[model samples]
Target chain A: MPQPSTRNRLLEHAEAVFRQKGFDGASVQDITRAADVPKGSFYNHFDSKQDLAVEIVHRYAGGTDLSPLGEGDSPVARLRAYLLGELERTEITGVEFGCLLGTFASDSATAGDRVREAVGEALASRSASLARTIEEGQATGAITARRPAGVLATFLVDALEGAILRAKTAVGPSTAAEEIDIALDALRP
Target chain B: MPQPSTRNRLLEHAEAVFRQKGFDGASVQDITRAADVPKGSFYNHFDSKQDLAVEIVHRYAGGTDLSPLGEGDSPVARLRAYLLGELERTEITGVEFGCLLGTFASDSATAGDRVREAVGEALASRSASLARTIEEGQATGAITARRPAGVLATFLVDALEGAILRAKTAVGPSTAAEEIDIALDALRP
Candidate 1:
């Protein structure tokens, strides 16, 4: 009912713009325009567009709901649920919007040091968590892949990102879920 | 031979800038600056920044040497060689530089319709070629997976793009080759 604070509004709008247009692709004016706030008020909240991007990275990574990973009894099944849940999300929002963390990963050139650092940490942390789950799966005999869990974890995450990027510009009816499924099946014993 | 033409110079430098900073991140001034040409001359060579980007997409895709795919006797090894050859390139250019086609794929928002079309066509064409090779591999029984060649091909290309993106923003020692190798092994019969 009550209006959110200006700072929160700025963050929400900035996230949308960043996800859609990437860090450098979207300008301060663009974010402010989307937020319907005066351009001058932008600097009042964030020091620079890059500053806003760093905050966004922190928030996006911190707020990610990994509860889907807890859905299934087996670790691999849970990982499948986690990944499929991601695809279902883009199914609702449209795949072209992309994930903010992934957008920043691909936009490191224009994203500057602070933003890159935040994205790097977020992606690394996510991959690390996935690796831990995969290791558990391996220990429990749910997964038979021989490669190190860390390696597989990183590969799977990268595959997800690649599928997302391809799906965004794809001319045909390619769904990221199918590509990711090919990956999940590969990990089976 | 005489010095390279101004137009050729713009194309080369524009490629460098776009590969480094992405389509929307680099301005016309940035291209001209990198090319050591006057800002006014940019319009003379191309109608606009987006126009030049489309041209770059065509040239980059058209110039990619998939011959490494012909390197080994087996189709899959050749594919590995081809993918490794791509990694060798970014190793020399710096992994942070990224592929122009992929940069455009991730930058579709600010890349405009024409650039997106060019990127989409190029990616589709590459994926199709990979699929054809994969079909050849499957016929020879080099690849064991039962997934359709088209699906497998799209999965491979998407995986490559994802590995590249992760390598760009990686904080640790994750190499694209290792991640890609994981994908290749997953194709084992």
Candidate 2:
């Protein structure tokens, strides 16, 4: 296959740096160095670090695998799979680095409104997707109707993000797995 | 009251700076500036930023009010009080700043082993304390025994941290409050 485009290379490397060092911590110089591209080339692709951050948020959110939420026979099973898939993805990406969306969200206060809004929108979209699944589960009587599906979906997202934070500082994925299990259990009718 | 100790003042300001700018994003200069002390004063109190960070984690963890977990007549009520106390604390501290332990934990991969281990220990201790309360709940028949108390405690911590992450970017505490309600609901026998 042909080599990756300059923009693709920058996005790929910049994501790792941002995930590892955070949006405020990672500078244009750092991104350029990691990408092995000159400093001048960065501006050619994105206007500012803030611009790059919004792009990264979009890229990361766009790539999230929601298929597990859609595929399983039962809503609870599908939700579990979706959450487990996230934990597995974090494991593959290196748990120590944690989630980019989480890291950015934590630092969004100082990162500017543009980046903050992008991260917010990305998370809202994820929550909406999960809400749809919960709605489906509620319709089938698989999940509890004590709370609105939208509310429960937001809770799952919050809990999953929280578990990832814990896993980042812990020994392995066991903590994350247990937390996800509890989150799914919370959804039972 | 007597003026706060210089060291205490430094820790207070440094925690806010770290929370807002992140560990990597905030430099010694920023901490000193925020603390209103000379750059030389920082060195006089601690060997390095990392040393100061370790102390901050200890202080934050120690200051966390687990009294709610100890006070109520019923185990579930006690647990609820404990968790709600935490949410209130986060609100007082400004959720926009998020949790310092969480903010540091996310960046631990590059923040060094000393900082990472200190944060990990702080969190582990907090979880242990919560687990003891959970065990108490289990023995009293106020909490389900379907899973180990230790497992449930860890999940509660994960979900709370995740909710804080969401509240940091959202408009108010409603989302965090709703999420916490669900987490507690999941614990019902």
Candidate 3:
């Protein structure tokens, strides 16, 4: 097996620490130590901690496995599948760490402009995906809606993130799944 | 006019700084400086910084000035009204601070159990209020739903909070309000 590239290794380590302690809470030393990389190597790999954080968020936003949402039979079914996937992720992580972007966004001090832009683009993309699914569902009569497709799509994404935040706060991943079902129920005919 | 009590003054200042800087990010000196109180006076008002933070959240959670969702309205309308009130608050503060309790709950690592419990109770209460409004809306037929009243209500609260977080990150308070309208729109018939 090919050894993980140093850049990839640095990003993986940064993500872990960033998730554990947030952008402001985590230090460069902590990140380098966690990555088991020398300080000089960390600088060589990334320009600054803030830059590394931006990249970490970009990587996560870039690589979310949204393929399952694409394969479902209907819009609502696809949305439910996506929510279930998030719920399963919570189960694996034990609800301590939530969406990395969300974790950083909640901290006003670390509200970096680039981080914000990346999140907005990612969310906008997700909203567009959901809108497409809703439109498909409407065209096929698999779903019924009186409002604009974009509105419903954005609502679903907003609710999912909020539900996850509450679940993480309550220390219960199951709550997030259940909340998603509530939104899903609304989408059913 | 009667002067505000010292304890109340501390709570106000702490809430502002805490919302902007988070638990670990805000320091005692910052709190005292903002309040214009002497360093020694801070301890005189509260047990510690953690104690003061708990009080601040408790105070904010209970201090919403908007009227409650009244009787006779459909639960959906009432729910919409309540959410609108919260959105209005975002505008009032320019969304500069977002939700204090949410900011706290999302970043309470340095805070003790008291602070966590205070925020949790507030969130739970907020969820319960929204759920009750949904139940009322279901009875009136002005709004329709597919899930149990409690679940829909919790989902609504979760979604709104997520929207606020997104708005804060995106630096567009209006986006948060718009996103909230999307979720509240779901309850309409």
DockQ by candidate, in order: 0.72, 0.73, 0.52
Q: Tell me how far the alpha carbon of residue A98 in candidate 1 is from the true structure, in angstroms, after superposition.
A: 1.6
The whole-model C-alpha lDDT of candidate 2 against the native structure comes to: 0.84
The CAPRI-style docking tier of model 3 reads medium
Best by lDDT: 2
User: Candidate 1 or 3, higher DockQ?
Assistant: 1
Query: Per-residue alpha-carbon lDDT of model 2 for B79-177, expressed as tens digits?
Result: 777877888887887878788888888878877888888888887888888899889888978888898898898888878889888777764335887
Error of 2 at B118 (Å): 1.4
Model 1, which residues run further than 4 Å from truth?
Answer: none
> Would you list the clashing residue pairs of candidate 2?
none
lDDT of 3 by residue, A127-152 (tens): 78788888887787766666667767
Candidate 2 interface RMSD (Å): 1.4
| Candidate 2 local lDDT, A1-189, one digit each (tens) | 999878888999989889878887788999999999989898899989999999999999999999988885788888888988877877888888888889888887788888888887888888999999999999989899989998898899889998888777764335787788788788878
lDDT of 1 at B72: 52
As for candidate 3, its clashing pairs are B75-B136, B75-B137, B76-B137
Compose the digit string of candidate 3's lDDT tens values, residues B148-189.
Answer: 666667777788888877777654334565666566655656
1 against 2, candidate with superior DockQ: 2
